[model samples]
Target: MISKNTIDQVFETARVEEVLGDFVQLKKSGSNYKGLSPFTDERSPSFMVSPVKQIWKDFSSGKGGNVVAFLMEHEHFTYPEAIKYLAKKYNIEIEETEQSSEQKQQEDERESMYLVSEFASKYFQNTLLKTEQGKAIGLSYFRERGFTDETIKKFQLGYCLDEWDAFTSEALRKGYKLEFLEKTGLSIVKGEKQFDRFKGRVMFPIHSMSGRVLGFGGRILTNDKKAAKYLNSPESEIYHKSKVLYGIFYAKQAIAKEDNCYLVEGYTDVIQMHQSGIENVVSSSGTALTSEQIRLISRLTKNITVLFDGDAAGMRASIRGIDLILEQGMNVKVCVFPDGEDPDSFARKNSQADLQEYLLENAKDFIEFKASLLFEDAKNDPVKRANLIQDMVSSISKIPNQIQQEVYIQECSRIMDISENVLFSTLSQILAREGKTSGVQPKKAPAMEVVRSPEAVKTKVDELFELERKIISLLMLYGTAEEEFEDMVLKENDKGELVMEPEIQKAKVFEKIFLDLQEDEVAFTNERFRELYSRIISLLNEEGEVNIEKFINGLDPELSSEVTTLLMEEEQYRLHEWERMNIMVKTKETTIARLVGETILALRRFLISQKIDDLSRKIKESSEEDTKESMEDIMDYLSLKKVLSNKLNRVM
Candidate 1:
C-alpha cells in the first residue's frame, strides 16, 4: 500500500500536460489543450486537458480524470502500478506503508522479480556498450544490420557474455535474490550450478505497455546447430509472451496517433522500420499471433496493417491471426514486401518517404489481399476456388458487427465472382452452425435520433432529472467560488400576515448550496445525484484542497463515467471553435454566483409546486374536514410559491 503523503506528493509534482504529452499529441486550444481521442479513433480532436485543474476529459470515450487515472485507463495498470510509474517518471522515491505479512510478501515477490529483470536488462546493455566482448560482437552485429546507436539504445538492445556464469555471478553479487533471478529465467539453476540463459547472444528486452522490462528475446551471433538460433525468456509470473508485443511500449503513442499499427515478424523488422521513421510498428517476436496481442493493439487503435515478409508460404500460414483481429471488430490490412525483401531489409534499402510511400501504396484491405493471393493458387480449379470463398466467409463471420459482415460479404461476392445470394447462404450456414444470429439484422429506430417522435409523452420526472443534473453540474463546475447570495425567508410580521424577507450572506458556492438544501430538507430522487452531491460537499469542506483526479479516480466505473460526462458536457459546445465566427460568447464563469442562486431557487419552486399539487389532490379525495385542512395547507404553499417565483423571476 502507498501512503497518502506519497500520493499527495506525486499529484503535486506530476504535471498532467507533461505526463500525457508523452502519449497524446496535444495542441493549445483556448485555455486548455485538445488532441485526437487516444481512447477512440476520430478525425477531429475531442480530447481536452486542463492544465489549471490538472484533469483530462475525452468527450468521445468519456474517460477522464487526473494523470494517474489516465495511466490506469491507457495502460490497464493497477492503482499502485500507476502511482509507481509516475513516481519513477518524476524521480520520486516511493515509500511503502506496512501491510500484512501475506499481502506484503505477495506484492514484494512480484516487485522483486521485476527489479531483478530490470537489473539484468541494464547489465546486458552495459556489457554491450561498455565491455570488450559485448561491444565487439553484440554492438557490431546490431550496427552491421543498420541499427543506429540511438535506435539500439532506444530499444534497450544489449548482449550477454559467452562465459557460463558471467550474468549469474554479477546478478547474485549485486544482491539480487537467487530465487528471483531463477524465476525470471535470467539464470538457469541446475543443482548447485547456475549459468546465464542467453550466453553469447544479443538481447532484445521486451517491455510492458507501461515500459517495465517484462522479459528478453536473445539472438545468437554464431549459428550453433546444437542450440536454438533465437532464445526467449520462458513463461514466468510477470512475462507471458502471448500477451506481449515487442516495441509496443515505444509504438503505442505512434499507433494511436496514426490510427494504425504495422505488424511484423521479427525484432529487426520493427527496429529497422522505427529507425526509418516508421514508429507505428510492433512484432510478434517470430511467434504466431494471439488474440491477446491483437486486443492489446486494439486498445490503442482499431486499424492494423500487417507487414508480411515476401515468403508466400509464411504469409498464408499467418492468415489465422487475421481472424483473431477480426473477432475483435478491428479493421486489418496486409502489406507484403517485394519478393526478395522483408520489412527490415526493405526499410534499410529505402528512404523514410519511400518506405512510407510503399506501405501506403501496397497496403490492401484484408479481403482484397486474401482474395488475390488465394485466387492465383486456385486458378483453373473449381474445388480450390470454392474453398477460397468459404475461407473469406469464415473470416467475415468472425466480425461481430453485422453491418461490417454484410459489407465484407458483398465485397467477397464481387472479388470471388460469386453471387450475393450464395455468399449470404454460406454466411448463414457458418453463423447458424456457430450459434450466432443470422447476419441480416433489420434496422430499427436509430438509438440516437435527430428528434424525438411526436407520439412520445413528456413527464415531470424528466424535468426533475434535469433539475437534479443541473445542481450537480453546478457543483462540479463552480463549487469553490465564493460570493454573496440573497436568501428569501417567509415570516409572520406584526400585521399577522405572511411576508417574504431577503437576507444577504457571504459564503462559498458549495456552502450556500449545502445550507440551502439542508434547510429545505431535500432528498434527491436520483441515486447518482444523491451520492455525487454528498461527495462534492465532502471535498469542498476539505479546506479547498479539492483534487479532481483523486475525486474521480476514487469513484466506481459507473460514477467515474458520470463525472467525466458531467465535466465535459459544457465543453462539448465550446469545442466547436465558436469564437472564430466573430460571435462574442458570454461564458457562465462570469455569473456562477447568480447561476448557483437561481438553480437553488428554481429547485425550491419545483418542490413547492409538487407539494401544492399533492395537497390539491387530497382536497378532492378526503372528507369535508380533511378537505378544509388540505385547502388551508394549499393556500399557505401557494403563498410560499409566489415568494419563490418572484425571486426566481428577478434572477431570470
Candidate 2:
C-alpha cells in the first residue's frame, strides 16, 4: 500500500491540467478548460476541467473526478496503478509502508504479470543494444526497415536471442519466477524444459493506454521456411488483443487534436506514419477489426480514415472495417496508396507534406470506395451487379444514424446508377428481414413521431435526490466553515405539557448538516450518498477541520468520483473570471446562513411530502379496522408537510 504522505505529496505536486492535456485537447473556456469528452463522443465540447478545483467533469457521461479518479476511469487502472502513474508523471518518489507477509501474499496476479512483462521488456531492449547476436540480427533488421535510432528507442524496439532457454535462464537467475515468465508469454515451459517464445525475433512492445507493457509482437528475422514470420504474446490477465490498438498510447493526444485518426494495418504502418509527421495514427496490428477497437478510437474522435495498400487484399480490408465504423455512428473515409505501395513504404518514399497532401486529395467516403471497388467485377453481369447492390445495402443497413444512412444511400445510388427509391426499398426489406430473424421489431419508416412522457404526474422521490445532492455538495465545499445555526427545541412549559422553543448556537457547517438531517430523521436513498454522508460526519468527529484532499483520498475511487461531481456540477464561474467579467455570483461564504437553512428546509419538505403520500396510500389500502388510525396519521403528516412547504415557500 502507498503511504499517506506519498499520496498527499503526489496530489500536491501533480497538476491536473498538465496530466490530462497529454490525453485530450483542451482549450481555454472561461476560467476552466473545455474539450470534447474523452469518455464519450461529442462534437461540441461538454467536458470541463477546473484548475482551481483540481477536478474534471464530463457532462456527456456524468463522470467527474480528481486526477487519480480520471486515470482510473479512463484507463481501467487499479488504485495502485493510478497512484504509481501520477507519481511517475509528477516525479514524486512513491513511499510504500511495509505490509505483513499475509497481506503481501494477497497482491493481485495481474500486477504480478505486469511486473514480469516490464522486466522482460527492459531485458530484451538491453540485449538488442548491448549483446553481439542481438545487435547483429535484431538491430540490423530494424535498421534495414529504415527505422532511425530515435524512432527505434521511442518504440522501445528490442530483440530476444535465438537460444531456446537464453531469456528463461536469465530471468530465473535474476530471481524472477518461471511462473510469471510463462504467464507473460516471454518464456514457454514444457515438463522439464523451457524455451523463449520469440527466439531470434525483433520485438515490438505493445502498451496499454497508460503506457504499461501489456504484451509484445515479435517478427522472426531468420529465413527458415518452417519458422513463423511473426509471433505475438498469448492472451493473459493483462492483455487482450481485441481491445487494444497498437499505437494508441502515443497517438491519443494527436488523434484528439486532429479530430481524426488515420487507421493502418501493422506496427510499422503506425511507426512510419508517426515518423513522417502524421502522429494521429493507430493500427489494428494486422488483426481483423473489432467493435472494441472502434470504440477505443471513438473516445478520441468520431472520424476514422483507413489507409489501405494498393493491393487487392487492402480492398477487402477496407470493406471489412467500414460497416463496423459506420455502425458506431463514425464517419469512415478510405485513402488508397498508389499501386504496389503500402503505408510503410509509401510514407518512407514521400516527404511528410507530400504524403499528407496525397491523403487529403485521395481520401474517399466509404460508399464511393466500396462502389468503385465492387463495380470492376460486377459491371457486365446483371446477377453480380445485383449482388453488389445488395452488398452495399447490407453495409448501409448497419448504420444506426438515419441521416448518415440517407447520405450514404444517395452517394451509393449515384455511383451505382440506381434510383434512390430502389435502394431505399431494398434497404427497407433487408432491415425488416433481419429484424424479424433477430426477434426485434423494425422501426417504422420516416413518419415516426416523437413521444414525450406525461408531465402531469410528479414524484416527491425525484425531488429528494436533487435536495440530497445539494446538501452533500454544500457540505463538501464548505463543511468546515463556521456558521450560526438555529433549531427548534422541545421543552416543558409552566404546565405539564411540552412546548417548542427556539435554540441558537454557533457550529461548523458539518455540525449543522449532521444535526439538521438527524433531527429530520431522513436517510439518503442512494447508497453512495449515504456512505459519503456517514464518512464526512465520522471524519469531522475524529478531526476538527475536514481536509478535502485527505477526505477524498480516503474514499474509494467510485465514491470519490461521485463526491467530485457533486462538488463541481454547479460551479461554472471561477472567482477571478467572475471578477474580470464584473459579475458577482453569490457564494456560500456570504450567504451561508440562508443557504444552510433553505437546503435543510427543502430536504425536510421533500421527506415530509414523501411520508404524507405513503400514509395516504396506506390509508386507502388498509383494512377497515386500521383505516381510521392510518387516516389520522395521514392527516397529521399532511399538516406537518403543509407547515414545512410554507416555510420553504414551496407549492404543496
**Model 2 lDDT per residue over 323-414, tens place:** 88888888889999988899999999999999999999999988788877888999999999999999988888888877777777888888
Give one digit per residue, the lDDT tens place, for model 1 in 313-403. 9888999998988998899999999898999999999999999999999999999989878998896899998998999999999999988
TM-score of every candidate: 0.77, 0.67
Task: Find the candidate with the highest lDDT and give its number.
Answer: 1
The best candidate by TM-score is 1
Model 1: worst 10 consecutive residues (lDDT sum): 437-446
What is the RMSD, in Å, between candidate 2 and the native fold over all Cα?
7.7
